[model samples]
Target: MQSSYLLTLLLFAVNAFAVSLPIRIVSWNVRFDADASTRQDGEKPWSTILCGIWSERCRKPHVIELLKNEAANTASPTIIGLQEVLDNQLEDIKGGLGSTWQHIGFGRDDGKKAGEYSPILYNTDALTLVFSEMKWLSPTPDEVSFGWGAGSRRVVTIGVFEHKATGKRFIHANTHLDNVSSEARSEGIKVVASRIKAVREQFGPLGATLTGDFNSEPNQDAYQTLEDMDFLTEVSKSEAVKIRNLDLTYTGFESEAGFSRIDFVWFGPTEQHFYAAQSWEVVNNVVDGVFISDHRLVVADLTAL
Candidate 1:
């Protein structure tokens, strides 16, 4: 489906004098770089360069370009949470975003370089890492294991960050709920929320943001359960909030393949927290001709309350 961008940022740009309480957050599930045999019709294998060194058919360059543009507005310090990222793809993103960007979280399978990472990337010039950790979404969260009949191991990357400019701190947690098991998705998010609360008890009272490809819609168990959570405030789904679009976030590569809203960004443990979402937008996933990822990323501006 079609989409638009943030008019708030545009106004910030044109007027230079616009009040900028710019703490921008993004949630995306960049489809894992897969083997050609498994590649679908609308999908392209990832590449690091342009052709001889990089080919036009490659998707990594495009992915990097999309991120670069997203992080372009420096006045708003950006924090990006990405899912389905292989270790190599993470490196490509780091390199593309350059030295000013830094990230946290390790692979879920081995806690090393073995599996996918739902990593949190931020601009170093804007934010300082206070604390971070990665935990499996299983009963044995401290160990590498699967949970609730899930097909594979899943993990949540949690980080506490301080805005260098204002000394404001916020917690950000990122994860991808399992697609194969409804029980896993449902139980896994409770694990995620408990972890965030644990973080808050240790370092909060400060505002917190959770970004992820939940794989479950608002009416579904996972999303609804999280909303039922007293500590968290749903931004993208809240009727009280004026969001630019509640459009489907996952396009499944082809327009006709699949359409759904399974991604979200939230703030908590109470709406009274310092971070109040100001503007929210579901960014267009298509760049030029290729879908940047199977899902459209969500962007939001938060004011420090």
Candidate 2:
């Protein structure tokens, strides 16, 4: 009789500890490392470049404000995966985000500070970083080099975090696959999948969320490669979730077309594990008729049950 009572008490205790936690994750491509002196096609010299600097500055404040709002509203700290970030832009964003925000990533060009970055940012007060890495999307992933006919040396940033309150850990990976090379996109995705699986295997039953600008549409092979993985599901397509602003992610100053829905947030571990998107949004990032980013932001309100 005493053993039965003890068993009942233990079950209750376990049930009490099984509380679900909500985490807000965002993925954005914030243009790139272009300054006022940069050049472009089909425009007067220094005209388009000067306008780009002004437009980016206008959008910077809005992006900072949105991050602050998200941090304030969520119980768990918000995780942001940013692509097309330059070293200067990263510092500027960190300053705007305040001291509590921390990030992990490196430039893909020289592996120091030459090229674009795919950085993952998180609030230090709500989470602790366990492990982080940056790898090139090439046949020789360990070194900074391009492969598979890639136009540039693309990279992926990954971080494993432990929730401060719940004692739960999860992996967050970020990347921007090559836009020009079809071979690079397909092979790059396979590498990402293998890396995600390897991380989970080493860490034990932990769920993972990968967010990025894949540069591929739903019908493309790169997108299909992800769907065939059988573990990852598009957060926007999840049942009971809301999808907003279902238009093109890349505006290219309204010149580019057919590149809709390239930015995405995918949730993995679809088995018995706890992962679901309650709501999703492709944030309308234009402010006062000026686009903040060439690529719109994608956000997901997720719950780990």
The per-model lDDT (C-alpha) reads 0.82, 0.78
lDDT, residue 133, candidate 1: 88
Pairs of residues at least 3 apart in sequence or in different chains that clash in candidate 2: none
| Cα lDDT of model 2 by residue, 1-305, tens digit | 99999998777645533766688889999877565476233112211334445644355665666666766776766999999888877887888888988999999998888899999999888889988888888889889899699988888888888877766778889989998899999899888877878887887667789999999988897888888877788786676367654566776544434257899888867665568678887776565565566777888888876
- Model 1 has how many clashing residue pairs? 6
Which residue ranges in model 2 land beyond 4 Å of their true spot? 1-17, 37-57, 255-259
Candidate 1 least-lDDT 10 residues = 12-21
Residue range 144-217, candidate 1, lDDT tens digits:
99999998899999999877665667789999999999999989999999898898899847678889999898
Against the hidden reference, what TM-scores do the models get? 0.88, 0.86
Q: Which residue pairs in candidate 1 collide?
A: 49-54, 50-54, 50-55, 51-54, 51-55, 231-269
Clashes of each: 6, 0
Worst 10 residues of 2 by lDDT: 39-48
